[model samples]
Target: MNRWFMTLLASLGLLLIVSGCSTKKDEAPKDPKAAAYDFSNEKSFVVYGEGIAPVHTVSPAQAIVLAKRAAITDGYRQLGEKLYGVKINSSETVKDAMIRDSRITAQVNALIKDAAITDATFKDGLYSIRMEITMSARRWHELFSY
Candidate 1:
């Protein structure tokens, strides 16, 4: 009876393992908003970012340049977030069943290559930039392998 029970348990475990195995190619993005875009119909991803001129800038030209640089940086950050999902760390302290302190942090790390700035404009002391990157099905896998 003991040997029969062990065999049955091992078979069930093996079945579960086999059923859980899945290929990475079919896995979809975890973010629900990702569903809005029909990636199958498109070959690239697009992101936009805006930056405002700081009050302390010396000249209008300098302010414009600064804002444009900031806008480019913002666009890159957005790309990183989309490619590599954000890492969130949270902690909470409870005293007498009441939460005393809580903290949450998010971080993203990604390597963006061959991204092109399609549109850029400065208006009313603000700079806006649109960035697009060409991504292939297997392109992302090559990014982190290095």
Candidate 2:
């Protein structure tokens, strides 16, 4: 009888272990941005941007509002970076040269204004925004045609 009881207990333990191992609850949370858009195609590029706001000495609502604004601005900046590549300059370059002389930056900023803000989140006193801009082949040509 004791042998049968031990066998039953061992079987139950094995069953529990197998069940736990097969469960999917341990999987990492999927990115919210990826869920909204398909990223596998080569035609579109996906980028993420984040902004942080402090909760100290501020109301919760105020913190959230500030963080969200910061996050949206950050998203626009990120989109601009993608549309217009960053310029690397030597130390000898003038401090205001790029801002004063470059029209590319202004053009990119104009494009970024039209980008879609796909996702925004406020968590742990930090706000994150994700912007998606589609650049199709025709659009690419049109941009360069200007």
In model 1, where is the ten-residue run with the lowest total lDDT? Answer: 137-146
Residue 64 CA displacement from its true place in model 2, Å: 0.7
For residues 6-120, could you state the per-residue lDDT of candidate 2 as single tens digits?
9999999999999989989746449865443543333454566677786584687877888888888777777667767566543333455553343232333335535777888
Evaluate residue 71 in candidate 2 and report its C-alpha lDDT on the 0 to 100 scale.
80
Best model per TM-score: 1
TM-score of 1: 0.63
- List where candidate 2 sits over 4 angstroms from the true fold: 1-42, 56-58, 90-110
User: What is the per-residue lDDT of model 1 for residues 20-63, given as tens digits with 9 covering 90 to 100?
Assistant: 78436578877776754434643578999899998897898899
At residue 126, give the lDDT of candidate 2. 82
| Model 1 clashing residue pairs (backbone) | none
Give the least accurate 10-residue stretch of model 2, judged by summed lDDT: 101-110
Give residue 98's error in model 2 in angstroms: 27
lDDT of 2 at 66: 81
